[model samples]
Target chain A: MLGLSKKDTTFLLVVIFLTLATPILLQPFPESSALAQFNAGYPDLMQRFAIFGIFAIGFNILFGLTGYLSFGHAAFLGVGSYSVVWMYKLLNYNVVPGLVLAIIMSGLFALFIGYISLRRSGIYFSILTLAFAQMSFNLAYSVLTPLTNGETGLQVYNNDPQVLMSEGSPTSPHFFGIVMNEATKVDVGGWQFTFSNGYYFCAIIAIIVFYLSLRIFRSPFGIMLRAIKTNQTRMNYTGLNPRPYTLAAFVISGMYAGLAGGLLAAMDPLAGAERMQWTASGEVVLMTILGGAGTLMGPVLGAGFIKYFENIFSKINDNILHSWFSALPDGLEDFVVFVFHPFIGKGWNLTLGLLFMLVVIFLPGGLIEGGTRIWNAITGKNRKKKREDAAHHPKPTSHVN
Target chain B: MGILEVSNVNKRFGGLQALGNVNLDIAKGTVHAIIGPNGAGKSTLLNCLIGKLIPDTGTVMFNGISVLGRKPYEINQLGISRVFQTPEIFGNLTVFENMLIPCFAKRDGSFRMHALESIAAERDIIEKAEHMLAEVNMSDKRHMTASSLSRGDKRRLEMAMCLVQEPKLLLLDEPTAGMARADTNNTIDLLNQIHDSREITMVIIEHDMHVVFSLAKRITVLAQGTPLVEDTPDNIKGHPKVKEAYLGEAAA
Candidate 1:
């Protein structure tokens, strides 16, 4: 079963099926309906979802298994994007070399950062990683303007030497002869579904990365990482070095972020310094935690949830709210829209923050735990005891003995 | 020559001397106990031996290898396993998973990348872990999380974790520190059985006299920051120096 156990193989299959069917599933609203505005099946948004999903999945490998919460993972993402754009500038529009260079460069960056950051654990480790990322972000913004192109971002110019580019090939990123942005729209009845080449490409890579993550989670290396999370002292005393294992996990996770960043650049041939900002890093963390940090499907779900809300929720204006409540009394509808004003439209981030807090407070295991709880309740199983035990043991606490 | 040899070890914390000019030789395949009152440098000496703390001026030789500046994991790879005063099992993992960790370390050295191999396919390691759990009478609780176990059971699991490595030297720091009398006796019996069945050596630091006499063949008593006496358990039982150091009685 692809080197996975029976249960893991089944889980991977379900993930593959769902990812492949995302465009169809996400476009349930008919084109004529008002809810159609909420649909997320558009090519641009779908590509963003898949790319961020890859980022969240990679972050989970470190934070979920080893309990090493890296606060600077976005630096790798930015580095990856820069590498891909550079590849486009120097090589060709083909994404293979760009992606390969992105992964290699980010892996080396992760190795250097991980080597230094892993010397400390807990919050200090987080601070060290954050500092490194901030330094990178600042450097890319100002000092390394020639390399990163300062505020304008790094992109392929018309005059740049692309040695590998054939004379008649498209200047934009492509997979051989197929342009990444090419999309096909099929209209059935009132429903319109968009199938984008870029989204499909990102989705396929995301599925492969997700499957590899499943293998890593079930492997002996995954067990060792969990062991390090639970009791690092015991790990050391048990004849295992936690440092090298943690460093490896960190590097692998960084490569995942780099792959995501490369995919983003492939879809849009630009690399922004803002992508390396701490806020971008925080978004991935929020996604992983909101969806469930340790669980396999949590991060991707979290990524989709956040991205979907960012697209749909931000579109809600007072006028749209009024239109939805038009059937109600005029005064009541006005009051209703006023009441909802702070949580919708430009305030969508406020709504997201509130939801994130609720998840952290009530459902510490993220959305996955909430789903499990509901399932257990419906099945009439007394899972309270088990849930209590898990809550009692939260994350591993450090102690000197 | 003994399996572990410590000589002229001195350690200080600020103005207070934690360990002063300590020397010891632990013979192979024997149970040696190091006992002392509160703050008598018993733990400091143990720390020095296990690479947790480096003595100011001393030499620690394990199987003739100088263990001066080695990391804890490196020291563990040299076949010396230490059980902490508090049970330090992987709380988030199952008892069976906890057992498999040490077995893997023993088989695959300190670190190996097996990220794609399934645990179920490792038939030999799984069987070995299960057998070790049965020996510790924890086979029924193998699937239970380590943190959910009772205190005494956690101690047993920790012992099983250390034993799975099959180390040359086993260090126990207060193995029965907070156990009931019955549990203490059970631990003593378990230690005695393990000692009789294997060629392993043990050095335990304990406050329990009953545990000290039951399992320790050789005893080293420390007072202040240095070893006061080293002798057999019987000779150490009623030594006048030990009584005075313990009871603060003036020598008569």
Candidate 2:
């Protein structure tokens, strides 16, 4: 955390190695190892982890650093998604153009919103962003029909004149004269893994974005934003008007959101206005807060966690659970089904709500706290250094300490 | 030539006239203290100087440039830094990281936007920050998280943060408001050490008479949002008007 020293970086790399390698090692286990389902190994889910991880990380840059609680960040994400899809429809299917569109559009949107919302502080800022996002959502669904395609969403079908895929060719709008229609699947001895080239392509972008966020988190500007969150008045009195610094943070985060949204659209060449809906924005906020607001890897972990639950829970029904538990004792099977009842079927949201509540109430800092707790538990340095650190700095509860 | 000038400055906040036609001039390298009672517009004056508040009718000149309508970061870029009564710092950051901000501001101006390169890699800034920390006797606490510092140390760190910018003017409000006598003495000594050693122009707004008299080269007393008198510590302590307007029963 101290500008990430070489030694500190070494420690971080070790953690990353452990997390990434864990899923590969889980391949040998039974299809349902207690932890196998949560390992984030599947290609579709893994790709999502990277994209939404980028989304939540970008959100954290604004919400976590500047202490601005945004309920409409998803609008930027949805806009990015729409722009990328439109790019694929009109231009070549190369990801670069989509990425650029996402950043530019997201940045433009953030600048507009930040200019107005940053005028007020506390709850007013949150609601202003929410209002702007709602405005975007309403326009995308109706007013911006030509671009956003109303409620039907934007998708690539070889319609009219804008088909770059060359009449009956299987390659969906080739990238730079090279068509990447080849889908590769690798099975490490019966785990049944399928990976589209798009997933890894997005995976690398997510990693780069993740690393960039880490750098921003530790920079001088990051510190200034955090300070602004803690005490804008004091900062202003200290001869530092927080507006410009916060505005910088807001724009950077907006660009990140745009990038994530753009990547999502590029992967599938379909953009729905629903993606820009307020609910989608709320989902990213959920992911960020559930994972850990200010911590680096928390957003990634939270994104992975939420996506995994969405995939697994959305498909599982009472019959599927009953069929699996049919072999158990009559009483035990009924009890098991009953336990998963409120959270198993259309109750995925109930589960999410419970998880959010638990994380918020017990661990307000999110997964970051859990990680630090684990690290502290293992190192046994907590008790000794606790007093010392406490003695050293007053640590006013103004912001993200 | 006057390095920093404020002429005919007036500030009104709704119903209150916080500063009434006030004018101030701070020479290049002098310790200028602004002393007033609880509601004498001490903070209002500092706020106007830093562009946190726009004066109703006035002009602020810093380094021969107009500072009347500049942003706080822009004013800071003009080499005017400020420290608060309560320690204003980045709690999550280390003591060392807190000092790098002004270096970037001073060298790179208000908007550096340097996305790459670790802040620690800025060796020149680090060296200078280290020097400032040593000046405040806080070099040993470099690696400590700023959130973990004692009250006295937080003030020292805040002082060093302002100093590292090498500002022509440093504005401090209540630098020793809530400190114990020992800590206050420590703060006074630290301010003295910097005043004796550095080429900084400081304007301090303090409630504590001991801190004000100890460090101020010249002190300005404000009563009812107007400058009561400007004099040396000896002259201020004995002046009937200052004592009557400030130090009488209420100053006790």
Candidate 3:
């Protein structure tokens, strides 16, 4: 189905089902329960999950497949957001034109940046990309203030000339006449689920890009990228140029970042220089690595994992911690909160850092490898099978004199 | 007329003349061997022909196209493939995938953005890869990782990768540099089969006398970056200049 192998098709179907049903899946805790704070069914956080998921998926194409670590991918994401917002100021609140322009503009940016950055590979290449991204961030923050609105960020204003806006059209970001922020709440007993127009829109785009990434992963171009990563010497002798292949991958991944950035603005209708920061670039790298760099579903899983921690874990303040441990003795409760304080709320980075370290050390292949290990353990499939299989298919022995 | 023509090729490296005043004409459809001792500049001359290094003053032409300053891939596109001393197969990919890359290169030129199409859908390329694997006696190991293959198998796979392109001239750089007696003979037999079956020209640079005499139709004795003599294998075996090249002053 869809020109994919049976295994890939099944994997893709599973991803689609999970993405479409994320609203209910994320709201496992009841509203009245103390654990309700953990529920991520709200439209704002859900939109981030889809948006960042797309961002990491695109980043994986360049970093994972080609083994070219791009440290400035967030530059493309920022460019994507600015394109969409500029479209909103010049065109209308409708997001289609903004999204279209976001993709095209970011592609051009990626082409220029990729052409230059790809000249040097390894750590030097990474530093070059980092430099370019930082340059872009500075430009957006100060020099390009007229376009980016300086520190205030770019937003749709009543005074701006929205050339395509009609009298009765929705004011906020919307597709046609449907407002993006509009949501329908479904309550089952104490549990609440929000199905938002914005989340679903981002979810649909995420699914499409995920499918495209999957196709690229299985395509000949994907194999060529892997070949470049493995051995450039062999590739050249085989009559394949690594430059064009790597550049194409870089542009494609940049476009993915752009699409994701555009989706972020579609949900919020704002563009800021902070989106292009080095930290933002590092976040996608963390997402790809934490999920499993080379695996298809790994990046999305990593994005969700990090976003969940950022939203849910960071909300665990001192009062919340105290409330949870209130049943214990006063002295013990104080000690418990003190121990947990450094890893939650404003210190959530501390927690994320610890987890990232653990994952890197114990699960070097990322969360996907951990999952595979668990699955293999459950199925009783051990490493011994490799030896047995090799034994069974012995290589044809060399002919003797 | 020879298919590969090298004339007045001189390469120097800071007080060292690696290949000085080298010249040769390799005929089409013949297994020609260039035999020399260590530091005789055999590999340097091979590198010059393949565009890995440019000679100070010379023209290295393949079928009349000068390959002096062309990129390695560009030279490869002009129908010249090189197999390294150590097998240079893609270690991370499976053996079958390794075969498919060269086939794709042969059909698609240097670049093609066939990103949306599935690799399995390329039926013709798959067939060609399978046929080539079978020819190399590696059909059973097609699914195995290229790196996991035995040393002999890696060499065979590398040779198969080059042959899949069906290049006009095949350059083998020490095809049996370090091998057991049995594996070396097996490689010789394999090379003999390939030479007998295909209309392909081959140039072999070798340190092994056995490998040199067993397969070469015509032989060039290179001594100190210059061709001392070019003769048939039978004539080369007893040539006084060839003796002096291999044995130094003792043979003279």
Best by DockQ, which number? 1
What is the TM-score of each candidate's chain B when compared with the real chain B?
Answer: 0.98, 0.92, 0.98
Every candidate's DockQ is: 0.71, 0.35, 0.68
Per-model TM-score on C-alpha atoms: 0.96, 0.87, 0.97
Model 2 complex DockQ against the native: 0.35
lDDT accuracy of residue A20 in candidate 1: 83
Candidate 2: which pairs clash?
A230-A398, A392-B148, A392-B149, A392-B150, A393-B148, A393-B149, A394-B149
Task: Encode model 3's per-residue lDDT on A1-401: one tens digit a residue.
Answer: 99999999998899899999999999999999999999998999999999999999999999888899999999999999999999889988999998998999999999999999999898999999999999999999999999898789999888999988888888899998889999999989988889999999999999999999999999999999999988999999999999999999999999999999998899888999999999999999999988988889889899999999999999999999999999999999999999999999989888999999888878877899899999988987866785677744434211110
How good is the docking of model 3, as DockQ?
A: 0.68
A326 Cα displacement, candidate 2 (Å) = 4.6
lDDT of 1 by residue, A1-401 (tens): 88887887888888888888888999999999999998898999999999999999999999999999999999999999999999999999999899999999999999999999999998999899999999999999999999999999999888999998887988789988788999899998999999988989999999999988988988889999999888989999998989889999999999999999999999999999999999999899999999998889999989999998999999999999999999999889999999999999999999999999898888888898889889898986866676766754445332110
Ranking of predictions according to TM-score: 3, 1, 2
Query: What interface RMSD does every candidate have?
Result: 1.9, 3.7, 2.6
1 versus 2: better lDDT goes to: 1
Native-referenced DockQ of model 1: 0.71
Tens digits of lDDT, candidate 3, B1-252: 799999999999989998888889999999999998889999999999999898999888889899988999999999999999999999878999999999999999999998999998999999999999999999999898787888999999999999989999999999998988889999999989988899789999999989999999999988888888999999999888877877887967
| Every prediction: chain A TM-score | 0.95, 0.87, 0.96
